[model samples]
Target: MNQQQFSSSHIPGLDRFWAVIPAGGVGTRLWPLSRAAAPKFLHDLTGSGQTLIRATYDRLHPLAGNNIMVVTGQAHRDAVCDQLSGVAEENFILEPEPKDSAAAIGVAAAVLFEQDPEAIMGSFAADQVIGPDDVFRTAVAEAIATAVTNKIVTIGIKPTYPSTGFGYIQKGEKLEIEAAPSAFKVDKFVEKPQADVAQRYVDSGQHFWNAGMFVAPVRLLLQHLQSNEPELFEGVTAIARARVAGDVTEPMAEIWPTLPKTSIDYAVAEPAAEAGDVAVIPGDFLWDDVGDFAAIARLNPAADESGVTVIGETPRVYADDANGVVVTDTSRVIALIGVENIVVVDTGDALLVTTTEHAQSVKQAVESIKAHGDDDVL
Candidate 1:
């Protein structure tokens, strides 16, 4: 994909648009800091004292032109408000219940459509970090342009490593247009693969990381949802109609629980890929979803040895450790000795100790905590 093929008609009035940020996930892998009540998106992991949601909002504000919509569970409304106090109150779409991305994006699409049927909406994850704002803006502009003429347009990150943690997108035939230089007709979408398979994908040069960033016209999105996922579309449309009628808060809460819990990828993207209605734009910005501890470790400043400690308010003491991660609260001192490839996270009420290789199983650890009726720890 290149830049010349995309014309102004492809992304009409992109500068005047609203951005949808889905912040409803319980980041189980990053527990105990990322608890069910307060996910990773609300935490200040970067040590720069800014929450992830704040950083993402700041990064997208320029292109969104001060219009932003955040979709989150009702349980997280206060935190979402606290983090995004700068945004308008009406812009926050608090889900009455957790219905996953399919419902969340559907609701957002309905809201955007009501505002402007032709409006271009950029859907994003609250946990991702993309650098070089110019690159992101350019790619998003191209996506918006493509989305005007296409059903759905997604930003595909140029893979930097053979990472098995993310899904991949296979680029198909190029479009014969000068305005859309970086856009391609998507051939297929692949889920996370094994190490060998991921390596092959990386070597193929035809694959790109599915960044989960999307852009589309509000009417187009609703049409696709109505055609592909009638249940989700109907639920969200009812919510929108209820909001327009009166008493939005009560009806939203009552209707959300009845919706299905499915991801947008499974409900829409994959189906669109199979139906040949999706397109991909090569993303040039440095991006990271910050999905796990390993990704965090990689983003942290390089250490002389193999280990790195992320110190919060609490001081961390380390000795005889290699390739280990130690996270602690601000008030206590965490001491580590003779540990390698280990992760030690000390919350005020709970502690998690696991090997780096088993970090992905932290969700299981949360389940154990739940089994013990220690919801406070979680």
Candidate 2:
């Protein structure tokens, strides 16, 4: 709960680890800038002018060095490589097809295990923004120490509000690991709940926002895959075997289709709760998934009258607006005279006008674009 209480100095024998970033998602939620060809992670959403993937690589470089492996689809392989030129070429694991996070994790684990069977793997998303690097590093260090002796360890962010967008982890009694004093046994992994249910969870003071960051030993994770999801394990093993046999391209294409499109949460974390093999460490650092335009708006400096402006080619003019986000790419001047709680996005080819209340539903607009068969606009 406090700084001294969550320090990582107590953890000894922590393994120096590698990081796996799953950058293959087609982020439809962040459309216009995000498309099937170039997803959100490839875009510079920060307005600070850095692509999300580049920022993530910079953040991970300190602990994992050039050992960061990026698993992406064949379509985005070139773009991913271009963005991550600082990383070694061999570190990019190109998936021949997309099969969600489970398969991505499997591929990275297989590759890492082949090199160092005892290696601890820390996995992250390509589209997240975590601040206060020292705090994040400390949490990761604690997670690595915990994973070396546990089955799977996850970094859990303290819930700041009743958020419906994220999954929640129910915290159990604190576990006294040798290195970290604040690790808790995971009781349950709940999916996105309804508003009232989410409010109850927040009131309980025993829940955390599941940040989807995980750390685990290669062997232990492989064991869970073999025992629980054998089909996926077999597919992953075949891919690893093919890589060893010098037929790298054929195996990923062959095995990706066979693997189920499930998330690590449904396949591993949820099951681990029943098996009592999961632990949660409180992450006190500032973290956000940057899942939508509103989340991006929250990161910007607050303006007068609850207005947030992202300056670009077209300057934003807002008046008497409260809790609104305005973005424009066209040079055309746009002004909101009396609008409140609205999202006004002006692109040359397309324009998005919605309320902040429906920010998450922007994915529907992306679908509409796809339905119109306008891939360029999406």
Candidate 3:
């Protein structure tokens, strides 16, 4: 993929920051194109010639230097190592199975805290598409500054429109910190709202789309997890301790799955926000989680006069009047006649046909296929 570079030396106070990448999830909504064996983060959904995780590494390595760790499933360990040559073996935290973000991030915090007492860790998803490097770098630099003051800081995307798919972060009082002048106290986190409610939030100018990105001192996170989720904290901490002692193979296998299956939002962010210990950095950049084909359509390059936005096999797709997204990894010609807002994903083993309106329900289709006992297709 084409990439832009940013100089970390120019930024202030990013020296002690370490980037933690949580690379899990199969991205079911973009199914057929995104599968179990090779998940979405492992693919170049943007047709940028670089996979999502690789792009994430490229974005963060300069800022964090060699202090980057990728927490991913064991099934993807080899691929993760292959793609990230700069990341050392010790920096790769391989999970036996999926335990969601809480466990994935918790372990990294615990380990980093032990390694460097002054370490501040920033946790970013491997699959998010970030636009405008300057904006992202500015936001992250301010976030790191805020985190040094011992606050759990999350970057909130400035809402361009009322989006019902993403959760909202309600910004409270403006913080008076010079390092992070644009930071504000997070009032509360609202779950993905109804259309009307989302519109109201947009009108109020107090809400930003939750991007699930956080920066905090490793000490702060470990302490919070220890107080709020003692059992989980104990398990992951034990795993980290075992790693420090040299053999984590056995303890990680035992403790990882035993940790609770929940998100970091539910585990820490909500409670911390209630206590006024969380801060929000207003992110003024184009960002997309790329949750479904509809989101992918918007991120793709603009469509031709015929109106179809195409990715992958661009030369093989012929659009007459179709006006949505068309993705193909196969050799067959994909001809779109008159379909509007439709999604056609052509893969070798299976093909998916749906509309942007119904793209979120494609997960249901995967379930239906599984119920029919076609594991091979999945």
Cα RMSDs, all models:
3.0, 3.1, 2.5
Q: Where is model 1 poorest over a 10-residue stretch in terms of lDDT?
A: 1-10
Give the CA lDDT, 0 to 100, for residue 305 in model 1. Answer: 61
The TM-score values for the models, in the order shown, are: 0.92, 0.91, 0.95
Backbone N/Cα/C clashes per model: 21, 1, 3
Candidate 3 residue pairs in backbone clash: 1-48, 1-49, 1-50
lDDT of 3 at 75: 95
Stretches of candidate 1 exceeding 4 Å from the true structure: 1-11, 302-306
Over the stretch 1-378, how does candidate 2's per-residue lDDT look in tens digits?
Answer: 233433224444343488899997777666665667778898776676888888888877766766788888888978888889877877778877777888899878877787888888989999888878678877887787788775588999988889988999998988887676778889999989998999999999899999999998878787777777889988888887777677788778767788878888877778877799889989998998878778767876554544655645556555454457777767777666667677777777878888778888989988877798987776
Badly placed stretches (over 4 Å) of model 3 are 1-13
Ranking by TM-score: 3, 1, 2
Model 3 scores a C-alpha lDDT of 0.88
Estimate candidate 1's alpha-carbon lDDT, on a 0 to 1 scale.
0.79
Instruction: Indicate the worst ten consecutive residues by lDDT in candidate 2.
Output: 1-10
**Best candidate per lDDT, number?**
3
The better candidate by TM-score, 2 or 3, is 3
